[model samples]
Target: MIILVAYDISDPGRRDRAAKLLQSMGLSRLQRSLYAGRGGAAKARDIARALERILDSETDVADILVLPDHAWSRRIEVGNGRARVPGRARPPGVHIA
Candidate 1:
């Protein structure tokens, strides 16, 4: 399973905290506010809940997308960056480990 976590935090402190939390969960940063990792359903839910708790519901927004192996296989990339999609052949420069 692959999990994509993205967040928008209004406060700089909270934003950094959120990034750190995600990193601690073994997620790799894909962009300033985007992260991806591999985990089971339970792990994904736990991470989502943890992120939700760290966020200010009134001011922050976070999204967690779970992609099964099949869904990830259909992903297409066209650019100069790396994408970590588990259980799939990655494009050049892409890293999935």
Candidate 2:
């Protein structure tokens, strides 16, 4: 499965920490606050727990979205520039939807 991890953290320090943590967990950065990678349900749960430990519930929000294999196959790419999905080699210059 493909996991999409996104977070909104108000504090710069906490945000940087979260980003580093996510990278350490094998998630690849997709955007400033968005990460994506392949991981199982167990991994997802572990990641959530780890994130929760460092994030302030009062001011920070984070989520992990699991994209099914079927949905991944049906993903649409609609731009001229290409993006790469973690752990997979895809054609260059297409954005997966």
Candidate 3:
């Protein structure tokens, strides 16, 4: 399965923080606010829990989409740039719980 996360955050700081958090959690950034990775329900739950702490309920919204094997197999890409894996790179002095 594949897990995709996208967010709309009002605060620049929180938005950047969320991106770093997602990267550290093993998701690859497909765009500025979109990410995709391989994970299950447990992993998606974990991500939601982590994101909740940094996102403002009133102003921020994060969407986590799950794609089954069949759906992922028919995926289409029109861009030349590939998804870049962030590989444990996190913000300085930030400790992810």
Q: Best TM-score goes to which candidate?
A: 3
RMSD of each predicted structure: 5.7, 4.4, 9.4
How would you encode candidate 3's per-residue C-alpha lDDT over 1-97 as one tens digit per residue?
Answer: 8898999999999999999999899997776788888898999999999999999999999999887866765665544343453343231222324
List the global CA lDDT of all models.
0.77, 0.79, 0.80
- Which residue window of length 10 is worst by lDDT in model 2? 85-94
Ranked by lDDT from best down, the candidates are 3, 2, 1
Which model scores highest in lDDT? 3
Q: What clash pairs does model 3 have?
A: none
Task: State candidate 2's TM-score.
Answer: 0.76
**lDDT by residue for model 1 over 1-91, one digit each (tens)?**
8887889999999999998999899888767787778877888889888888789999999989887866655665554244443333242
User: Cα RMSD for candidate 1?
Assistant: 5.7
Q: What lDDT does candidate 2 reach at residue 17? A: 94
Two-way lDDT contest, 1 vs 3, winner: 3
Candidate 2's C-alpha runs over 4 A off are 73-97
